[model samples]
Target: MSVRTMNRRAVLLAGGASLLLAGCTSTSAPARVALAAAPETPKSPDSVPPHVQAMYAAVMDEPYPIRASRMHLVPERFWRQEVTDPTGEKPGSVVVDTTDRFLYHVRDDGTAMRYGVGIGAAGFEWSGRAHIAYKREWPTWTPPSDMIARHPELERYRHGMEPGPDNPMGPRALYIHQGNVDTLYRIHGNPDETTIGKAVSSGCVRLLPQDVIHLHANVVSGSPLLVV
Candidate 1:
């Protein structure tokens, strides 16, 4: 098995052992278990992934909130634009507009937290509504085989890449799913702040570190995430 897979197994084993020792066999309360299972530090910014050294070097200057680009004060119009939402909000929810590159966390007060995002390329784009089935603080990124096929330079790390500052997912990830199907699209952090309001991703939603940190704090599993 790959190192990452083995690490994941070790984590599961350790968590299971702890649970067994604690005599807490209840699965009805998964939130507690999930909290216990979350990884604290998934990746490091300075360490480059396999063959992505150049791309990583371009973005490995400084951490978020301190990066020069993040402090530039972006306008709201960059991420706040209307879209067709005939179904309306379902109590507390969220919606993302790929055309305008904005994500809205709908509040009960009829307003929302507007944040800019980087969207997928034309052919790799996704539309329609999906639920946030899972959320991770710092997610590991296993480049899809297609991605490696297109960019053979990335083939070396096809299995899975460790989570860290260099990981494209940034500081957090919210996995969207339609029913039981994994959309494979994620609302994740981007170390490249310049990509904000840009349509240049491989099907995943990319957010500047500041915006992602804000979204991560507010979003929860089961939240409705509409991408259109």
Candidate 2:
């Protein structure tokens, strides 16, 4: 195979989203097919729209290297964009519609910033209202006991894995809580670019690393979040 194909496959499998934590341990798509249609592979940044490339641009100053996501891997609809407020909950409210796999952060204006998120498996999902208790930059990752049982090698990280590119938590993590109680779920970053809009994870919602950074800066402690 060509070098480009190899690179695309490598990126898709690198730290896949399913291996991410179902809990905050420490830190931290849809498609159509047509007959004879060209296979849909992740697109190079230059081949994608300029806005998308800009939105997911690589970080120059992050402690760990955070390359821009393969924007084309995710449906264009899931790419971070603004839309009219449909929740009407209130400004500054963060809403996650797991059914539609969309997260909306209502702005003071009528528009809300919508992001596509990869949710967890069935029977492992969390819904209802919660709040962002705090935020972490490159937060450490601690594999829960159950996870360790499944992958004994993770026992080494029982204490917590140092934050870095390889850390599944990516470069940012938002701790979700319900009234001072750690819900054990998080809205965190995933360096893997392929899991943005599919149900491929354990439970925690995963956002592209770049998109999470944008969200991490705008939100504050106690930001109300509704997962429906």
Candidate 3:
């Protein structure tokens, strides 16, 4: 997925959007289809329109490392967690280290599975603990009033936007709540790859499509999350 710049000056495409994991030594190839056909793979930047390129440049300062292997498309190191046995905590365990832009799933042997994420900006961020009160697959997006006030163009979709490739919430979303109050934040998939490791979101933490799917499958409703 791609995001418009904070200044609304450019658009930035998310990482892992248009890539295919063939082999580490394989040459970069052009995208074979439109975004909807393959949400996991994105068209090569060079094949993207000039406007798209221009928009991407404004929102992103740099690009994510292109990792490839014969067996895996992305290296585990990008997310920065050591994988342990997945048996201990089948559910109800989460950790978000905001300082490092990582969210981890605790495992049985004391190790964790970590993923890179995009965090909220100043004045719109949240920390501390929350629970995964709900989970939605391809959730609709309803930009908050504050977000709409900041960007009037979003007013048309205030009610809710349908779930699909263009929707900001890609693949899955886990709502965070504190007691009975919904935190209005989520752990969801991002459209822009470069947002990871950067403070570019409103409040919710963003993850890659593949990683988000992986985590979504592991986490259950009412799970505890520690964000420090």
lDDT of each: 0.56, 0.72, 0.57
The residue ranges of model 2 lying beyond 4 angstroms of the native Cα positions read 1-47
Runs off by more than 4 Å, candidate 3: 1-77, 84-91
Name the better of 1 and 2 by lDDT: 2
Model 1, residue 154: what's the lDDT?
A: 61
Give lDDT for model 3: 0.57
In candidate 1, what are the lDDT values of residues 45-155, reduced to their tens digit?
A: 333233333212233333432242332333334433333332245545767766556677777655666676777654556666668997887667766656665666665
Which ten contiguous residues of candidate 3 have the minimum total lDDT?
Answer: 19-28
Using lDDT as the measure, which candidate wins? 2
The residue-by-residue lDDT of candidate 3 on 6-123, one tens digit each, is 1121112111112111110000112122111111323354444454333223322113221221112222234434555232334347866566566778775667777777676544
Which whole-number lDDT from 0 to 100 does residue 88 have in model 3? 36
lDDT tens readout by residue for model 2, 159-203: 999988888888898988777777778888986656666665557
Q: How far is 81's C-alpha from truth in model 2 (Å)?
A: 0.3
lDDT of 3 at 153: 76
What are the per-model C-alpha RMSD values against the true structure? 17.8, 11.3, 15.9
